[model samples]
Target: MRLFSTSARLLFNNAETKQMRAQLDETLKLFKEKVSKIKSDTSVTTDKYKNIAVDLGNGNTTELKQISTIALRGNNINIVAFDPKQVKRMQTALIQKLGVSATLSPHNTQTLLVPVQTMTGERRAQQDQLMKKLYEQLRNDARDRNSISSIRQKYLQPVRKRMQKKEGESKPELKKESEAIEKLVREYQDKLTDLYKKQ
Candidate 1:
Protein backbone atom coordinates (compact mmCIF):
# COMPACT_ATOMS: atom_id res chain seq x y z
CA MET A 1 0.00 0.00 0.00
CA ARG A 2 1.36 3.45 -0.96
CA LEU A 3 0.20 5.14 2.24
CA PHE A 4 1.82 8.47 3.25
CA SER A 5 2.21 11.20 5.90
CA THR A 6 4.44 14.28 6.24
CA SER A 7 6.86 15.52 8.93
CA ALA A 8 10.03 17.62 9.06
CA ARG A 9 11.60 15.13 11.49
CA LEU A 10 14.50 14.76 9.14
CA LEU A 11 15.16 18.45 9.77
CA PHE A 12 14.24 18.09 13.43
CA ASN A 13 14.35 15.10 15.86
CA ASN A 14 17.89 14.59 14.60
CA ALA A 15 16.71 11.28 13.23
CA GLU A 16 19.72 9.11 12.35
CA THR A 17 19.25 8.92 8.60
CA LYS A 18 20.65 5.41 8.46
CA GLN A 19 18.89 4.28 11.65
CA MET A 20 15.62 5.48 10.16
CA ARG A 21 16.51 3.75 6.92
CA ALA A 22 17.59 0.50 8.60
CA GLN A 23 14.22 0.48 10.33
CA LEU A 24 12.47 0.59 6.96
CA ASP A 25 14.00 -1.57 4.23
CA GLU A 26 10.70 -3.04 3.00
CA THR A 27 9.15 0.37 2.50
CA LEU A 28 12.17 1.53 0.51
CA LYS A 29 11.87 -1.46 -1.79
CA LEU A 30 8.22 -0.63 -2.51
CA PHE A 31 9.08 2.93 -3.54
CA LYS A 32 11.99 1.72 -5.66
CA GLU A 33 9.48 -0.45 -7.50
CA LYS A 34 7.00 2.36 -8.16
CA VAL A 35 9.26 5.21 -9.24
CA SER A 36 11.67 4.36 -12.06
CA LYS A 37 14.34 6.81 -10.89
CA ILE A 38 15.08 7.43 -7.21
CA LYS A 39 17.58 10.03 -6.03
CA SER A 40 19.07 10.01 -2.57
CA ASP A 41 18.17 13.23 -0.74
CA THR A 42 21.87 14.07 -0.23
CA SER A 43 23.58 12.62 -3.31
CA VAL A 44 24.77 14.85 -6.16
CA THR A 45 24.71 13.76 -9.82
CA THR A 46 25.87 15.36 -13.09
CA ASP A 47 22.36 15.62 -14.55
CA LYS A 48 19.66 17.93 -13.28
CA TYR A 49 17.43 16.32 -10.68
CA LYS A 50 14.01 15.75 -12.18
CA ASN A 51 11.14 15.55 -9.69
CA ILE A 52 9.61 12.11 -9.27
CA ALA A 53 6.05 11.12 -8.47
CA VAL A 54 5.67 9.21 -5.19
CA ASP A 55 2.14 7.88 -4.91
CA LEU A 56 1.04 9.17 -1.55
CA GLY A 57 -2.27 7.41 -1.06
CA ASN A 58 -5.47 8.67 -2.71
CA GLY A 59 -3.47 10.28 -5.53
CA ASN A 60 -1.66 12.78 -3.28
CA THR A 61 2.05 13.16 -4.06
CA THR A 62 5.38 14.67 -3.08
CA GLU A 63 5.81 16.05 -6.61
CA LEU A 64 6.24 19.63 -5.37
CA LYS A 65 9.64 21.31 -5.04
CA GLN A 66 8.65 22.30 -1.48
CA ILE A 67 9.11 18.74 -0.22
CA SER A 68 12.33 18.96 1.76
CA THR A 69 12.47 15.67 3.62
CA ILE A 70 11.04 12.23 2.99
CA ALA A 71 10.73 9.85 5.97
CA LEU A 72 9.24 6.42 6.22
CA ARG A 73 6.03 6.11 8.27
CA GLY A 74 4.65 2.60 8.81
CA ASN A 75 4.10 1.31 5.25
CA ASN A 76 3.80 4.91 4.09
CA ILE A 77 6.04 7.95 3.68
CA ASN A 78 6.21 11.25 5.53
CA ILE A 79 7.00 14.15 3.22
CA VAL A 80 8.37 17.12 5.18
CA ALA A 81 6.59 19.98 3.54
CA PHE A 82 8.45 23.27 3.35
CA ASP A 83 5.19 25.05 2.58
CA PRO A 84 3.06 25.67 5.71
CA LYS A 85 -0.29 25.10 4.02
CA GLN A 86 1.10 21.90 2.53
CA VAL A 87 1.62 20.68 6.10
CA LYS A 88 -2.08 21.05 6.82
CA ARG A 89 -2.98 19.50 3.49
CA MET A 90 -0.79 16.53 4.35
CA GLN A 91 -2.66 16.03 7.61
CA THR A 92 -6.01 16.41 5.87
CA ALA A 93 -4.95 14.02 3.14
CA LEU A 94 -3.95 11.30 5.58
CA ILE A 95 -7.18 11.68 7.56
CA GLN A 96 -9.29 11.50 4.42
CA LYS A 97 -7.42 8.66 2.74
CA LEU A 98 -6.47 6.46 5.66
CA GLY A 99 -8.45 7.65 8.70
CA VAL A 100 -8.49 10.21 11.52
CA SER A 101 -6.28 7.71 13.33
CA ALA A 102 -3.75 8.07 10.54
CA THR A 103 -3.42 11.85 10.88
CA LEU A 104 -0.15 12.95 12.46
CA SER A 105 1.14 16.40 13.31
CA PRO A 106 3.94 17.53 11.01
CA HIS A 107 7.39 17.53 12.60
CA ASN A 108 7.59 20.91 14.35
CA THR A 109 9.92 23.19 12.46
CA GLN A 110 12.24 25.73 14.15
CA THR A 111 11.08 27.79 11.25
CA LEU A 112 7.63 29.28 11.90
CA LEU A 113 4.52 27.92 10.23
CA VAL A 114 2.50 30.94 9.17
CA PRO A 115 -1.15 29.99 8.88
CA VAL A 116 -2.28 31.31 5.51
CA GLN A 117 -6.01 32.14 5.28
CA THR A 118 -8.67 33.69 3.04
CA MET A 119 -7.42 35.24 -0.24
CA THR A 120 -3.78 34.27 0.16
CA GLY A 121 -4.77 30.73 1.07
CA GLU A 122 -7.02 30.50 -1.97
CA ARG A 123 -4.30 31.65 -4.32
CA ARG A 124 -1.67 29.34 -2.87
CA ALA A 125 -4.07 26.43 -2.85
CA GLN A 126 -4.91 27.14 -6.49
CA GLN A 127 -1.24 27.21 -7.32
CA ASP A 128 -0.61 23.91 -5.56
CA GLN A 129 -3.61 22.30 -7.20
CA LEU A 130 -2.51 23.65 -10.54
CA MET A 131 0.96 22.20 -10.00
CA LYS A 132 -0.56 18.78 -9.37
CA LYS A 133 -2.81 19.14 -12.40
CA LEU A 134 0.13 20.23 -14.50
CA TYR A 135 2.03 17.12 -13.45
CA GLU A 136 -0.88 14.99 -14.59
CA GLN A 137 -1.20 16.97 -17.80
CA LEU A 138 2.46 16.46 -18.61
CA ARG A 139 2.15 12.73 -18.02
CA ASN A 140 -0.88 12.58 -20.32
CA ASP A 141 0.95 14.58 -22.94
CA ALA A 142 3.86 12.07 -22.83
CA ARG A 143 1.45 9.19 -23.32
CA ASP A 144 -0.18 11.04 -26.22
CA ARG A 145 3.24 11.79 -27.69
CA ASN A 146 4.09 8.09 -27.61
CA SER A 147 0.78 7.34 -29.34
CA ILE A 148 1.53 9.96 -31.98
CA SER A 149 4.97 8.46 -32.54
CA SER A 150 3.44 5.02 -33.08
CA ILE A 151 0.84 6.45 -35.42
CA ARG A 152 3.57 8.26 -37.33
CA GLN A 153 5.55 5.02 -37.53
CA LYS A 154 2.43 3.24 -38.80
CA TYR A 155 1.85 5.84 -41.57
CA LEU A 156 5.52 6.04 -42.52
CA GLN A 157 5.92 2.28 -42.76
CA PRO A 158 4.08 2.18 -46.11
CA VAL A 159 6.17 5.01 -47.48
CA ARG A 160 9.32 3.20 -46.47
CA LYS A 161 8.09 0.05 -48.12
CA ARG A 162 7.32 1.95 -51.36
CA MET A 163 10.83 3.47 -51.35
CA GLN A 164 12.35 0.02 -50.84
CA LYS A 165 10.27 -1.28 -53.77
CA LYS A 166 11.47 1.56 -56.04
CA GLU A 167 15.06 0.87 -55.03
CA GLY A 168 14.51 -2.83 -55.84
CA GLU A 169 12.95 -1.97 -59.22
CA SER A 170 16.01 0.14 -60.20
CA LYS A 171 18.51 -2.51 -59.03
CA PRO A 172 18.43 -4.46 -62.38
CA GLU A 173 18.97 -1.29 -64.42
CA LEU A 174 21.95 -0.44 -62.25
CA LYS A 175 23.32 -3.94 -62.77
CA LYS A 176 22.73 -3.66 -66.56
CA GLU A 177 24.63 -0.35 -66.65
CA SER A 178 27.49 -1.95 -64.70
CA GLU A 179 27.54 -4.95 -67.07
CA ALA A 180 27.41 -2.68 -70.20
CA ILE A 181 30.30 -0.62 -68.79
CA GLU A 182 32.28 -3.84 -68.18
CA LYS A 183 31.49 -4.98 -71.75
CA LEU A 184 32.65 -1.65 -73.16
CA VAL A 185 35.88 -1.90 -71.13
CA ARG A 186 36.49 -5.41 -72.49
CA GLU A 187 35.71 -4.26 -76.08
CA TYR A 188 37.77 -1.04 -75.82
CA GLN A 189 40.35 0.35 -73.32
CA ASP A 190 37.73 2.66 -71.73
CA LYS A 191 38.25 5.49 -69.20
CA LEU A 192 34.71 4.74 -68.02
CA THR A 193 35.91 1.37 -66.58
CA ASP A 194 38.53 3.21 -64.53
CA LEU A 195 35.83 5.64 -63.33
CA TYR A 196 33.55 2.70 -62.47
CA LYS A 197 36.40 1.03 -60.53
CA LYS A 198 37.13 4.31 -58.74
CA GLN A 199 33.41 4.77 -58.00
Candidate 2:
Protein backbone atom coordinates (compact mmCIF):
# COMPACT_ATOMS: atom_id res chain seq x y z
CA MET A 1 0.00 0.00 0.00
CA ARG A 2 2.85 2.38 0.88
CA LEU A 3 4.63 1.75 -2.43
CA PHE A 4 1.42 2.20 -4.37
CA SER A 5 0.73 5.54 -2.69
CA THR A 6 4.23 6.83 -3.44
CA SER A 7 3.95 5.79 -7.04
CA ALA A 8 0.61 7.57 -7.42
CA ARG A 9 2.01 10.77 -5.96
CA LEU A 10 4.94 10.68 -8.37
CA LEU A 11 2.62 10.13 -11.32
CA PHE A 12 0.45 13.04 -10.28
CA ASN A 13 3.47 15.35 -10.01
CA ASN A 14 4.67 14.30 -13.45
CA ALA A 15 1.25 14.98 -14.93
CA GLU A 16 1.10 18.41 -13.33
CA THR A 17 4.57 19.27 -14.62
CA LYS A 18 3.58 18.23 -18.13
CA GLN A 19 0.44 20.37 -17.91
CA MET A 20 2.46 23.42 -16.88
CA ARG A 21 4.97 22.91 -19.66
CA ALA A 22 2.18 22.58 -22.20
CA GLN A 23 0.62 25.86 -21.02
CA LEU A 24 3.96 27.64 -21.30
CA ASP A 25 4.52 26.21 -24.77
CA GLU A 26 1.16 27.56 -25.87
CA THR A 27 2.07 31.01 -24.58
CA LEU A 28 5.36 30.89 -26.47
CA LYS A 29 3.60 29.86 -29.68
CA LEU A 30 1.25 32.86 -29.53
CA PHE A 31 4.17 35.24 -28.94
CA LYS A 32 5.98 33.81 -31.97
CA GLU A 33 2.90 34.33 -34.13
CA LYS A 34 2.67 37.98 -33.13
CA VAL A 35 6.34 38.46 -33.92
CA SER A 36 5.91 36.89 -37.35
CA LYS A 37 2.94 39.15 -38.13
CA ILE A 38 4.94 42.24 -37.23
CA LYS A 39 7.80 41.14 -39.47
CA SER A 40 5.44 40.48 -42.37
CA ASP A 41 3.73 43.86 -41.95
CA THR A 42 7.07 45.67 -41.99
CA SER A 43 8.53 43.84 -45.01
CA VAL A 44 8.57 45.58 -48.40
CA THR A 45 7.01 42.90 -50.59
CA THR A 46 4.65 42.70 -53.57
CA ASP A 47 2.11 40.81 -51.48
CA LYS A 48 1.76 43.83 -49.22
CA TYR A 49 0.78 46.10 -52.12
CA LYS A 50 -1.57 43.51 -53.54
CA ASN A 51 -3.65 43.73 -50.39
CA ILE A 52 -4.05 47.52 -50.47
CA ALA A 53 -7.64 48.78 -50.67
CA VAL A 54 -8.48 51.28 -53.39
CA ASP A 55 -11.51 53.56 -52.94
CA LEU A 56 -13.59 53.45 -56.16
CA GLY A 57 -14.84 57.05 -55.49
CA ASN A 58 -18.39 55.68 -55.10
CA GLY A 59 -17.73 54.88 -51.45
CA ASN A 60 -17.04 51.23 -52.34
CA THR A 61 -13.53 49.84 -51.96
CA THR A 62 -11.80 47.06 -53.85
CA GLU A 63 -8.57 45.26 -53.25
CA LEU A 64 -5.83 46.17 -55.72
CA LYS A 65 -5.08 42.52 -56.46
CA GLN A 66 -8.76 41.77 -57.12
CA ILE A 67 -9.04 44.38 -59.86
CA SER A 68 -5.56 44.04 -61.35
CA THR A 69 -2.75 41.58 -61.79
CA ILE A 70 0.41 42.63 -59.97
CA ALA A 71 3.91 41.54 -60.87
CA LEU A 72 7.37 42.64 -59.88
CA ARG A 73 9.72 43.54 -62.73
CA GLY A 74 13.22 44.20 -61.43
CA ASN A 75 12.66 46.74 -58.64
CA ASN A 76 9.34 47.98 -60.02
CA ILE A 77 5.81 46.76 -59.37
CA ASN A 78 3.74 46.48 -62.54
CA ILE A 79 -0.02 46.56 -62.05
CA VAL A 80 -2.27 45.96 -65.03
CA ALA A 81 -5.99 46.43 -64.70
CA PHE A 82 -8.04 43.67 -66.33
CA ASP A 83 -10.66 46.14 -67.59
CA PRO A 84 -9.45 49.10 -69.60
CA LYS A 85 -12.21 51.38 -68.31
CA GLN A 86 -11.07 50.85 -64.73
CA VAL A 87 -7.53 51.97 -65.62
CA LYS A 88 -8.05 55.64 -64.91
CA ARG A 89 -9.82 54.94 -61.64
CA MET A 90 -7.08 52.51 -60.64
CA GLN A 91 -4.48 55.13 -61.55
CA THR A 92 -6.22 57.72 -59.44
CA ALA A 93 -6.54 55.33 -56.54
CA LEU A 94 -2.93 54.18 -56.82
CA ILE A 95 -1.76 57.77 -56.88
CA GLN A 96 -3.93 58.59 -53.90
CA LYS A 97 -2.55 55.55 -52.11
CA LEU A 98 1.10 55.88 -53.13
CA GLY A 99 1.36 59.62 -53.69
CA VAL A 100 3.86 60.44 -56.50
CA SER A 101 5.52 57.05 -56.02
CA ALA A 102 2.95 55.44 -58.38
CA THR A 103 2.79 56.53 -62.02
CA LEU A 104 0.75 55.51 -65.05
CA SER A 105 2.85 53.82 -67.71
CA PRO A 106 3.46 56.17 -70.57
CA HIS A 107 2.86 53.53 -73.27
CA ASN A 108 0.09 51.57 -71.56
CA THR A 109 -2.89 53.43 -70.22
CA GLN A 110 -4.18 50.29 -68.56
CA THR A 111 -0.97 49.73 -66.63
CA LEU A 112 0.61 51.44 -63.62
CA LEU A 113 4.26 51.29 -62.59
CA VAL A 114 5.49 51.75 -59.07
CA PRO A 115 9.22 51.88 -58.43
CA VAL A 116 10.18 50.34 -55.14
CA GLN A 117 11.70 52.94 -52.85
CA THR A 118 15.21 52.33 -51.65
CA MET A 119 15.82 52.56 -47.92
CA THR A 120 17.40 55.99 -47.89
CA GLY A 121 18.96 57.47 -44.73
CA GLU A 122 15.75 59.14 -43.60
CA ARG A 123 13.63 56.08 -44.34
CA ARG A 124 16.14 53.78 -42.66
CA ALA A 125 16.04 55.88 -39.50
CA GLN A 126 12.25 55.87 -39.54
CA GLN A 127 12.15 52.11 -40.03
CA ASP A 128 14.58 51.60 -37.17
CA GLN A 129 12.45 53.70 -34.83
CA LEU A 130 9.31 51.84 -35.84
CA MET A 131 10.97 48.48 -35.36
CA LYS A 132 12.25 49.56 -31.97
CA LYS A 133 8.77 50.51 -30.86
CA LEU A 134 7.26 47.26 -32.15
CA TYR A 135 9.94 45.17 -30.46
CA GLU A 136 9.41 46.94 -27.15
CA GLN A 137 5.67 46.41 -27.39
CA LEU A 138 6.10 42.72 -28.12
CA ARG A 139 8.43 42.35 -25.15
CA ASN A 140 5.98 44.13 -22.89
CA ASP A 141 3.09 42.00 -24.04
CA ALA A 142 5.01 38.78 -23.56
CA ARG A 143 6.18 39.88 -20.14
CA ASP A 144 2.65 40.61 -19.07
CA ARG A 145 1.29 37.32 -20.36
CA ASN A 146 4.04 35.17 -18.90
CA SER A 147 4.78 36.91 -15.65
CA ILE A 148 5.26 34.66 -12.58
CA SER A 149 2.09 35.88 -10.89
CA SER A 150 0.07 35.51 -14.04
CA ILE A 151 1.32 31.98 -14.57
CA ARG A 152 0.51 31.10 -10.96
CA GLN A 153 -2.99 32.39 -11.36
CA LYS A 154 -3.74 30.77 -14.68
CA TYR A 155 -1.84 27.46 -14.44
CA LEU A 156 -0.65 26.71 -10.93
CA GLN A 157 -3.90 27.42 -9.16
CA PRO A 158 -5.72 24.50 -10.71
CA VAL A 159 -2.93 22.10 -9.86
CA ARG A 160 -2.85 23.37 -6.31
CA LYS A 161 -6.57 22.88 -5.95
CA ARG A 162 -6.30 19.30 -7.14
CA MET A 163 -3.45 18.59 -4.73
CA GLN A 164 -5.44 20.04 -1.82
CA LYS A 165 -8.23 17.56 -2.40
CA LYS A 166 -5.86 14.58 -2.03
CA GLU A 167 -5.35 13.08 1.45
CA GLY A 168 -1.85 13.25 3.02
CA GLU A 169 -0.29 14.63 -0.14
CA SER A 170 2.52 17.07 0.58
CA LYS A 171 2.25 20.57 -0.86
CA PRO A 172 3.23 20.70 -4.52
CA GLU A 173 6.87 21.57 -5.16
CA LEU A 174 5.89 24.87 -6.66
CA LYS A 175 9.26 26.54 -6.16
CA LYS A 176 10.92 23.98 -8.41
CA GLU A 177 8.12 24.24 -10.95
CA SER A 178 8.23 28.02 -10.84
CA GLU A 179 11.96 27.96 -11.52
CA ALA A 180 11.39 25.65 -14.51
CA ILE A 181 8.68 27.91 -15.84
CA GLU A 182 10.91 30.94 -15.46
CA LYS A 183 13.67 29.23 -17.42
CA LEU A 184 11.29 28.48 -20.26
CA VAL A 185 10.08 32.07 -20.30
CA ARG A 186 13.63 33.37 -20.41
CA GLU A 187 14.46 31.17 -23.41
CA TYR A 188 11.54 32.66 -25.34
CA GLN A 189 12.47 36.16 -24.23
CA ASP A 190 16.00 35.61 -25.54
CA LYS A 191 14.60 34.44 -28.86
CA LEU A 192 12.52 37.64 -29.12
CA THR A 193 15.58 39.74 -28.31
CA ASP A 194 17.61 37.95 -30.96
CA LEU A 195 14.89 38.45 -33.54
CA TYR A 196 14.76 42.19 -32.79
CA LYS A 197 18.52 42.49 -33.00
CA LYS A 198 18.49 40.80 -36.40
CA GLN A 199 15.91 43.28 -37.73
Q: Every model's Cα RMSD, please?
A: 28.7, 5.6
Clashing pairs in 1: 5-78
Local accuracy of candidate 1 as per-residue lDDT tens digits, 21-130: 23233322333332223222112221221144334557767643345455444433444567645555545544454343323445563121222123345554554454
Which ranges in model 2 have alpha carbons more than 4 Å from their true place? Answer: 1-12, 51-62, 96-101, 119-143, 146-199
In candidate 1, position 113 carries an lDDT of 25
Indicate the TM-score of model 2.
0.58
Candidate 1 whole-model C-alpha lDDT, 0 to 1: 0.36
Which regions of candidate 1 fall more than 4 Å away from where they truly are?
1-68, 73-77, 100-199
lDDT of 2 at 36: 66
Candidate 2: C-alpha lDDT: 0.65
lDDT string for model 2 (17-44, tens) is 6775676556555555665665555545
lDDT of each: 0.36, 0.65
